[model samples]
Target chain A: MSEAARKGMKPKKNRAGLWGIYLALALIYIWAFSGMNLPEIKPTAGQITKSIFNGMFHPDWDYVSDPGGEDLLHGLLDTLAIAALGTFISAVLCVPFAFWAAANMSKGKAASGTGKFVLSFIRTFPELVMAIMFIKAVGPGSFAGVLALGLHSIGMLGKLFSEEVENMDLGPTEALMATGANRFQILWFAVIPQVITGFLSYTLYRFEINVRSAAVLGVIGAGGIGTPLIFALTSRDWNRVGIILLGIIVMVTVIDLISGYLRRKIV
Target chain B: MMNQPIKTSIPKPPSKIKNYVTLLLVLFLLWGSSIQTDSSLAELVAGFPNMMDLLNQMVPPNWGYFDNITDAMLETIRMAVIGTTFGAILAIPIALFSASNLIQNIWVFYPIRFILNLIRTVPDLLLASIFVAIFGLGSLPGILALMVFSIGLIAKLTYESIEAIDPGPLEAMEAVGANKIQLIVFGVIPQVAAHFISYVLYTFEINVRAAAVLGLVGAGGIGLFYNKTLGFLEYDKTSSIIIYTLVAVLAIDYISTKLREKLL
Candidate 1:
């Protein structure tokens, strides 16, 4: 049965068709450019270079230690607090939802499949889009930022949790069930041990991502450092901008170092 | 020979009251967070209609505005392509250094991992903003930001995959008197190259989306246009930009996913 079908199967003659599309697109581009009489880009590289040095390199030392410094510090604190709270909430909520969504933990396919579809939809939209929507409803603040971060984290954590569940060893679970343990007892004794380290690693990793996301949620008026950052940059306050950048770099580097250390110890 | 069962001590189970107390504590925390955040269920319900109203405003999107955004849209894709390529090239050495199996010294791997972690900690928007502050607002800063962002992403994934690879080929290379560089070239790179490209393309897809939004921070690309249009409350133009972005992202994601499936 297999040999007959294998002989009958002919590779589709679609290779030329693919190249035909590419050629067509190239021609269209050329034609469009000629018709439009596209203007040549003559950007002044020297001007850009001068501006970079003036605005970026010659950072305002006075601003770094003055009112700009105070504003930047407050922004930094706000960003960190929101990120921390969001990560904590998401980790707590996502653990139980992940268990229900994971194939190995749920009793049947229906429950797991439904849980997964909901999470998938949540993941399809970016955090910015969610923040925009929440800001419209809740008004711009750290609360909206937290909600956006938490929802997005749920999707990420759920997927990671399912993977951890899928790759777990089944031997201990069978042994625990053989001892006449209830569902909860079996899960606690068998499943949690294998997945605890993985769960911790995933949470730490998400925390790193959350810190980054929270820093920018302010662009949409969801609150945090982004508001002040946008203000300083647009105002051409190079000194304040430099201070903000410095603060962000320091904070992110520290979070990275601590999370990295913890992850290594756990794993 | 004496055969005796090996026995391990098992602790007593926690009482039911303990479980209930833990549950109560969790509930308390949830309530506390909700109160602090002022997330009332009543507010959410009341706000549902506003969401519907916003959606209503966005519907029947102005298709004509698509033409206006075409150039910015193409630039965004171009930025992503260049950025992803640059990042992937840099990721190779960083990933090699970070892989536990490849780097025998704990010191080297730990430090390399620390750098990767730090790079990954900053969101694409924040990175773009910082770069813009340094480089001045333009496509160059956008590209640089995306390049750094993609490097962090690809290095993390590639190194994790590398650590999980079969060590047999590496052992054989070492047995053949290969130096460290030669051993990696012969033993490690080939096995992980396809997966590496898969990660690169996946990161490229993300970079495309991220680049589209970088303009919001004045870094460069289509996002600047987004900010401009949305600033004036030009919902029609905003809708057009969003539609174009969604279509481009979906198309790239489809192709990338297919390629990744084939490579892996």
Candidate 2:
């Protein structure tokens, strides 16, 4: 509309518009920060910081090697076990459901929709919530954590597996069908071979995530490092908390390395 | 004469032995882990009745509890919004520094990556617990925890995307004598902006779900009510909270997914 615009002259940078956005964002930050009621930094804040640093450097050696009940090592093992078992169980159990959920594989639209809906429902609850519910059912322990992780993983694994199934090369299946193979025969010879690698990759990936989840499940008494973590924090035992945190970091790192290596090798 | 007897050596399908051994090893590990964790079919079967009872109790959720939880739910969303926005803001620098393509010096990117990995290993629950200790109880601790969590996530995702970006603009910018900051601003940001926003929204979706449970450790959110209701064995009330959280999470997920689809 302007002669300069019509002549293709450069327009001014919308400085006002840019500033308005910045101001709005700043206001939002202020509102949110105010809602938090952040505690004023007291002199004790310095002491707390110092203690945290000290604890980080000097973790409780006794607790780290303690062979007694529910020590860091035992907690680490339990967490690993939960993650491993949960991933395995979910990978095994998701196969049927995945087939049911895959539109190309399922009997009809209704079956696929129902399968997907069930999975969505399963996935709705956070792992912690599921852990709590499982704790209520099975009593708080690593077993409950495993159950929680497994049940929650089914939703994810099923979805991933179904996608794999849906996108699979139809060549093999069509070939087998043309040879008058039965449904189960075709599935065994065609579907499983194509999706096995993807299924394993997804399961391994899920295991890595589950390890992290299992580490924190104990906060809800579902059982893991999280219980000791909360205990130490509550009672102000920063040294033990430091050790637990360290163990978790090491465990996660090692698991990630191994899983990453395996995934690369397989996939 | 008949074609010289075709000597076809079928390459023996590479070692079924190896495959069998790997399968066995995996199975063994699974069995051992199942025993160690005390997770077995029998236990699950035994717990079926209790699970049924819990589900039975959860039906007919206490609708009245919705009024009480509205504020907490809003606080949770606000916490996620603030946490994710702050995290995304902070992540830009870290992601820039950590990206191997952006920072040619291995030393610079390596240490940044180590820090990112270390940060990511700490679960949000653990972060909240530590923050709650320092901040005293409230949504402040939850916000801080989510912020740290988001930083690790967004940075990791963003740096990976940054590494995969087209190098043409970056090289062109450099050839034009653009400074490091200028190159990033004009070249890098334009290329990665969509991906970065998508990562931020994805992280926000996770944060919303995570925020709902931060209250378990006194970090503040609907999880406080979750703890309270469950402590009182008020399954009906707990069910309502779960329902509300489900709705919020699903809505956020849907919107974020749509936004991401548009972006990419």
Candidate 3:
């Protein structure tokens, strides 16, 4: 122990690095603020703000549902559906990628390293960007959103799944090997069984995140509640916008709660 | 060959009923989702040729168009830097208040935590869209949106970590008759400083990604170019923008990750 601490007093802290940190921080702040013009409050900002608050307090209850057609309820359901399918597709597809990326599953670091690189590369593309790309291919609809989410989620899921594989107990693999089990057999019986629960929990976690993404995909015409939300935004229909925002918040919160509970149960 | 009973009986495996039920539910949800989204194999097949056409056009990215987006790309980084700094600054009080172990008042922490959670539910881009409505089309809305996003993320993580900080030091400080501020400065800050800094850095990384896409709603960033290129069917330019974004994001991620490892 330091002499000060040994004497029941405070030890002197190293402060040399603190000044450097402060200087760098100051420089960064200066650089950040130098580029842009100050923000202008829109002329209608006050009126719009008042209206938005009023609309939020008195949401258009009529927009909650319409007779057998698109409404808030359907919008929320479509968002949930997109999240569910996307999570499922990614969960199933990430398995092979996970196996490829897991260090224990590969013969050499090079193999797993390449797999890791690919996953990271995929991760850089936001699902929104992917949705745009898919809309070009599949047309602007909820299906495009699904494809985007499904594709984008593989990056995160593959990384998480691979880590789970790497952490799997090796005893069973060795025991099965001693019994003359084939490679696939060893993996199927030993690795798969151990990691399935972890994988499921991660998938549910991703599902929760996907719900938020799916809600906004409609802004670009990729489909879901976002489509209606964007329309409400453009039309300056404060009540409609308020209700859609409310729907999104409620849906996201509910899904997060359920998924979090399930994850806790699994893990 | 005979199916013979083992001399030493092994216990049967755990019930698979839960697994079976989960699998069934997943399958049903997938079926419903596909129908609801109008996703069909036939449509995918039909679209394959179009995708191939897009790929053919995208291979030769317009490297020359990089000049146009350079300013916007830098603006994106600037937005992230400012937003994350502002967020880290604001998160301190919120995090301190929400950390029940520190504040020791249910009434104080509970409402703060609830509002924090509510803020976290809205996506960053959605927040940007709202800010755009209020501030008009500019980087200000984007910066404000990212700042708000970073607040939710950083404060939540910071408070959680704060609650887990070592209590012995605080107790010692209390025994020394230190007041609340003194106790916090002498005890709490030292313990959580590294963690708080690391969380802020992590938020910066996420904000960079979010900021890049904020331009979609006229919030200002590289996302504005994404809309422009796509709207004009300039596939080549779109590819270049994507490439630039990827390189910038990856570079930042590498440096920030290294810094986090050192800090923590």
Candidate 4:
């Protein structure tokens, strides 16, 4: 500053680091893109676009409101039910596990580590894989979907809940302990209250995600809209596919708005 | 003193009735939905036997199947890498445009955010299936789907972080009469680069997991094997695939999480 200001000259920017990063990123991009084995874009692009657009504009309304058959409405309801039940079951099951996983609550590194490992193991399996396994167990229906979503949600919700517990104000907990309250009583009166709102917020967020997942779980015969969606696509029933996609979009949007509002109100 | 205290005006604590009402409503909804979905403890109990049977069948995994699936697993990782890289590239401009603190114009940020939200609403599976239809069954479609998904996620996360960054440097750049591009390059980029890299890595982690299943929709990946083994009732091979995928995912997650910890 002293030298440059006195000379009335602007200092050069030190851009070597930035340039290096850009160079590395460029190399990575080239390597990765080349490895993808991308197929050549077919000349049928225009036809596919036109067909998709046409179907979108003319979604089968009968399928939209059909009450007597496996229509968009029925599929939407099933997806909603799956997400709700899954979120509820997981949210409930997460409590005890979250308590065990929270470093503060467990009060031992070994116990908390074991709990974290269990959660990580559970989380490693994608909901789709879990759904496939549960389909084998419960035999291809909404039950399998619910169980799969519920179990997967436990991994996510439990981790989040334990983090919340770990970060909570310990003053109240200590005060309760000082008052000669037992561990369970302190947990109920002190710990649970502080984290309940955060727990609810996470559950709602997971529910939103589960709704989207439930839509796709049906592809593997785990029940919900995915079954109809995959079937329509496979059979080249563009009109039906359009309706299903539209239903999914609308349902997801509505859930997003509601959950977003609730999260803001709570968190 | 007691009489004076009795006359003191203390505002009552807000009633917890609202909380209880919401809780009850949520509980009722869960109950009704459980009934509607035909999910119950009884059914779960009955399914336990089947679950055990499946688990028993999977205990001795077909380790020989590892050779067959190795290339597919590599393809899955490659797809994630390429897709995440492409998405990170696309996300830069979108995040810049959508960041309220950077863009300032409501119209610009709002429209971009709407588009991002709409993209995010489509689940990765649906996106993969759609791309498969458009591009035919291959890793190309899977790559495209992951790219789009990563774009939505990365842009959203990056833009939010961009908005939260300190405004002091940006203001200083403006005071120095720096041009718009110069201001951003010298100010915003430096601040957000670390966060952007962290977000990119996180997206890669998610994409790896997502890509593993993209094959289910014929978009190409390890999911193809999942479908094959499950269709053939070869739980042993399925278990092996699961184990391999789990190891890969866990390794990536650990590395990325550690990197993110350092960045933050």
Candidate 5:
């Protein structure tokens, strides 16, 4: 029992090691916050209460029914269109690229690495940055926004697809290959069926994201509801800001719920 | 099994209902999208000249601007490192609570999950913009945004890993009458720490890319230079920024990928 007691309760000989880790983590945080000029965020209880109430009740619904509100609605519609198109485009492009990028399928280091690099290069640039670049090239408009969203979405979706492929059950793929099916046939019969659900799930998820991205494309003149939203904010039109926020929240929440349902069904 | 399949009826061509339905949907999607987007082949074709013009301007990147981008690039990487470190630290408690294995209570887990889900739905750009608006513009907002973004990402990843962890150690800890804190420290943390580190590094890589673009909204870092170059229509400078950012991202990615490979 004395030997067992000692065995159950190991002596803590290196408490300093744990403490050193904590100290290092602390130093990192302090260093990170070193140049942070944290402003006094004094949103008085009263201001918060007002904002909540204003957001809830005074949503400026009248603007939605106004003639000018038509413009906002159009912008919203445009954002949705862009996001949908972007997701669709990415779905079309990414599925094959993802397969090629998957290590299992390519079996060639060059193909997978090249595919991965292409995808990472796409992911490295935010949509806004992409839009700015494309806008400079193509001139400003929804076209630029669509292209940016599509390209970036390709990068993201391709990467996710590759990960899914990498993690997929190898048994089915091997079985298909053993049947002497060609690459395309094997992929179609084996790989695609297995990963289609995941593909759809990721695509829907990206659609949810593209909705938000499309909204902000306006900030960079990519042409969406964000243009007006930014304009409203700049003009200090809290009433309009309130409307935009409400609209955005509703759009986002609805999309989220739908996408969540779709994702659950797919997964 | 053979007898059951022998009774199969002759298969027809694609079901008219399904085929037509799909065809109609495709047509509708194309028509609706084209009209809604005001997109046309004519527009795409017309835009080529301008694209070429822009590309021509972008070529032969301004070698002189390379030096300025170095500092900006360094700042961006630093912002990502700081943000990711802070976020990774803060994620631990939230991830713990959200994990099904640790917190058997649905009440605590669900609420935290809902919050994380909501936070994740808010894209990094939107978060940065909101923070910039609230805090005024600079790297501070960028860093804060990255922190929040990293937290959302890492916590979600960690909890998923937590849910999938081996339960034997957890039961063993419980059998030993260890308290919740001790059980987690010894049982849960050991199993998940590597994965947690992997996620943090993954988030750091994302944050670097994210931070590079944060400056577009005046949140700070290389994105400011991006905005300026593009604003002045200095495509060469813009190209230089793009190239530099690409190199930095590629380097970070290569290192992180190598490290992550070893980690797991």
Candidate 6:
């Protein structure tokens, strides 16, 4: 039976198709490998690597607090604040976009399709780039980080919100319509009630992500732990870098756990 | 959507207190955050013209700048390809170990899963910056960072898929006195290979985007051009770099997404 199946015309064609894919993959890999220009080895590479590892093991605990507001604690606070405001801004801005992108809400596929396209276009721009743009506007600070994250979160949040809208129980909308409720009434009483929880849950999820992004926004002088982090790295302050990384890890982990629990309760 | 009992003369509405409290709390939180972050609407309004001026200068992207960036962009894609390849290779054993269904040992999977979660917590850019700090900058650091990120992402997705694979073939193989390695080869690999490939492609899509920005921390890519242009006040060139990155990211995303769709 195996020999007959293996020798079948369909099997033969399948094998040929698989080989073609393999051949193409091999060529692509070769091209990629050829383009690689590995950097020359720095003489101190091993020593630096060992020092970084050692720093991680013995992180400077003193950096955890300071009278000055520029310590790790304050940087984390600024990061959280930026993330919170950013999430709030996106949560508000995305509501209309969500309705626009929802296929069921729009009369025609073209309308919804364009909205989807616009959201994806927005999503393609990384938040870091947006931060730079905003820095040009606000002259660099936590404000720029907030604006950037707020703007960038819309892409993801809008898409998620639109899906929530599309997947909602239409029975409620239909029933509301039968009751002669206007669009606003239907939206407020029927659509809003169903989607509000999903929207809040998604915003929380985005907040967790924004925190991570915000942690690095400071690298560009947009203001966060990242600013100090870059400063430490440049000055070869490995222990400071260690503390910041640890703080980020802890903060992100805590945010994820809290948001996950809340989302579970919400959904 | 509202339903009422026909037998009841009148039904009292549920309390709106929770709704009011939640709204109030949200408003208070927003207020506090805005203050903490020094985010003022007035400042944003005042700065709007500056933003417009910057945007005005960015018009007419320097078409000539594309030639300079072509190599850097190609290098970014190469880094992503090699990184994802390495990650996928390394992820196989990690994914296999972490999949509780396959390993069947708390001691084996839990610590690995914990490490996986910790790795996932760090953003790719942060990883790149950290590597750059240690290695003192280069494309190698970017590649290493991407490899670490892909390991986290690919392993998590692969193990999840592995756990969800059809158990029938696994049980049959076991029933036939197949050893662990034989059971995996005859049963597990066949079912998971497609999903694993799909996940790897998905990771590649993300890696391209991350790799493009790695140079921000001096790890490598077209991102360094961003610094150069902005530092030089070459707004037109900066815009071109952004456009280049956008096109590259979109193209890779499109290809990998299509491939993943076909695979899965």
Every candidate's lDDT: 0.78, 0.90, 0.90, 0.90, 0.81, 0.90
Q: What are the per-model C-alpha RMSD values against the true structure?
A: 7.9, 3.5, 3.9, 3.7, 5.0, 3.5
Alpha-carbon shift of residue B238 in model 6 (angstroms)? 1.1
**Model 6 TM-score, 2 decimals:** 0.95
Best by DockQ: 3
Q: Write the per-residue lDDT of candidate 1 for residues B36-153, one digit (tens) a residue.
A: 4556657767777876776677787889988888888887887887788789999999999999887789999999888887677667887787667556667877888999999999
| Candidate 6 C-alpha RMSD relative to the actual structure | 3.5
Better of 1 and 2 by DockQ: 2
lDDT of 4 by residue, B1-264 (tens): 445545467888999999899779988998888877888788778988999999999999999999999989988988999889889999999999999988888989999999998899999999899878877888988999999999999999999999998999989889989887997799899899999999999999999999999999998989899989988999999999999999999998898899799788
DockQ of each: 0.19, 0.66, 0.70, 0.59, 0.33, 0.69
Residue-wise C-alpha lDDT for candidate 6, range B1-264, written one tens digit per residue: 788657845667899999899889988988988988899999999999999999999999999989999999998899999999999899999999999999999999999999999999988888888788767778989999999999999999999999999999999888889999998898999999999899998899888988888898898888888889999999999889889989988988888888888887
Instruction: Give the runs in model 4 whose Cα sits over 4 Å from its true position.
Output: A1-34, B1-17
Q: Candidate order by DockQ, highest to lowest?
A: 3, 6, 2, 4, 5, 1
Per-prediction fnat? 0.18, 0.71, 0.67, 0.62, 0.31, 0.68
Candidate 5 C-alpha lDDT tens digits along A102-193: 89778699999998888888877666777886676567777778778888899989999999999888787788788887978877787778
For residues A38-69, could you state the per-residue lDDT of candidate 1 as single tens digits?
22333654554466456656665564444645
Interface Cα RMSD, each model: 5.0, 1.8, 1.0, 1.6, 3.4, 1.1
User: Between prediction 1 and prediction 5, which has the larger lDDT?
Assistant: 5
Between prediction 2 and prediction 6, the one with superior DockQ is 6
Candidate 1: C-alpha RMSD after superposition: 7.9
Model 3: what TM-score?
A: 0.95
Candidate 5's displacement at residue B182, Å, is 2.7
Q: How much is the lDDT of residue A250 in candidate 6?
A: 95
For model 1 chain A, give the 10-residue run with minimal summed lDDT. Answer: A32-41
